[model samples]
Target: MSTPVQRLTAEVNGITLSYLSQGEGPLVVFMHGFPDLAISWRHQMKAVSDGGYRAVAPDMRGYGASSAPDDPALYTQFHIAGDIVGLMDHLGEKSAVLVGHDMGANADWAMATFVPERVRGVVVLSIPHKPRGTQPPVASAPPRFYQKLFQAIGVEDDDLHRNVKTFLPAIFDRLSGSSEHGAPPSLMVPEGKHFSDLFEPPSKTPEWLGEAELAEYVATFERTGFRGALNWYRNIDSNWWTAAPWTPGHVTVPAAFMIGTADVAWALFKDNGVIDSQKERVPNLLDMRVLEGVGHWIAQEAPDEVNDLLLNFLAKLEARDS
Candidate 1:
């Protein structure tokens, strides 16, 4: 039998955040990426809770049932990190193990960098921490990078919102490494085309993502247009500017990074020494695990493997503490 996962709300950083939690022990907060909800971490949450730790996964500040601040500027790394810290305060926890995926991994890097003391250990999935680069991301990235397309406001949202159902599944299929779907490596929208115009309708949802699961994501985006989520992308350059002062900082806390071999982000960064560069940027990085034949949606696609890695990391931390 599985323990029931509870839905709860917290007043953190002057906003309401909806989250899912299970068990009642040391804090292990999971932060999910864009186009995903707290439920995305259900497998990990249950695994951790069953292992005698309290596990929590928040919908983040601007997604799902959480309060979405209209201003794009409000979605910076500083703001997102503050919300996680505030969540700790609300839960009366002095410190916690922070686990983040995708954009949430970016926030995990920020939290571990800016407020090292509050984070006992850190785990980032899909995205690795790259210290401030010489040039702006948009300029430095290849012309085909999706982040560039995402930077343009209104355009991406219009296409995404216009074809929510088709667009969402297409993204999952393409980004996933499932041989069944045969998705491409890059998700770049054509130069003169809309974002939704790039993908053909998926014949079926990938094994990692079921129709029921995709429906949940579709319903959320349908209720709350893609504006809030897109705002995260809009602030990319601004976040780069805000992080200038912390350029010299490194993730001093114990950290681990994991990514799927087939992840689009990894494919782009791997050639650029991004994965190897973690040694200098995250000096205390404990491990870097690359799962073969996996894709961007790692947690959902390989929950058992992800949970095992997380548990192994947690066990190491516990042994050290004891």
Candidate 2:
């Protein structure tokens, strides 16, 4: 049996962040993306912890057990980088390896850029450290892009709120490698359909996600609503503005990146210049793995593979540090 993860909270950045921790040693913080909670890293946390490295996954600013701010403007990258650095201060640590996926990945990039001294190394899944374009993100977004659709605000929340239980599971199924969900439609929103309408709910829970595991997410969203999460997207343009001074700044720390071939992010963002220019920007990027058939839910869809990759990276990180 695996060691049970401990639940803890840190009062940081003027808010409380509930985080899951396992193992003991140097700190490694895992951040989850939109539509996901800290538990999303349950698999990686265990593997890395067992591999003899501390793993910490937090319910980021607008998700799950963490406090969610009401104003979308509060979700900027500046706030994100601060929360993480503050979390480290709360834990009394001076440095850590940062691991992130999706929105979590975005925050990791920001933290690495904003506070390089605090990062020992970095691991990112799905999203690469794409340098900012000259134009504002929202203004430059593709037609009917999901991120664009999100600017409508309350559109997705109203749709998903209609059937939290039914719609929530679909996102997991359709986003995983196991799903027959052919090329994901433009992420956030390609056709301008309601968030729930864009996906077909699975007939059964995905193999990687247990019904009980899914129940937790459903219950959480059902209670918290998707406002805090959607608010992240609402502030993309503002994030670009805050990111202005740091645009083109690369993550100089040792880094690794992984993405599933079937992930919707790959299909939608492949040509957006993030993946293409990842190497030029993230110079220390040591490993880049492409999981042949996995999707956005890399940790859940292929836990064993993800675990091995994380352990390998952690080992390399320790070697580099020592």
The 0-to-1 C-alpha lDDT of every candidate, in the order given, reads 0.85, 0.84
Mark the regions of model 2 whose C-alpha exceeds 4 Å error after superposition.
188-192, 271-273
lDDT: worst 10-residue window of model 1:
179-188
Off by over 4 Å in 1: 139-144, 179-183
Model 1 gets an lDDT of 0.85
Worst 10 residues of 2 by lDDT: 183-192
Q: 1-322 in candidate 2: lDDT tens per residue?
A: 4677999999988788999999887898998997899988988888888777788999999888899988888888888888889988988899999988888888888888878999988888998788777898887978676777777777876777777888888888887878766655556554646767778887888878898889999999988898889888888888888777876777898889889989987886687666877889998888888889889988788889877777888888878768
Q: Whole-model lDDT for model 2 versus the true structure?
A: 0.84
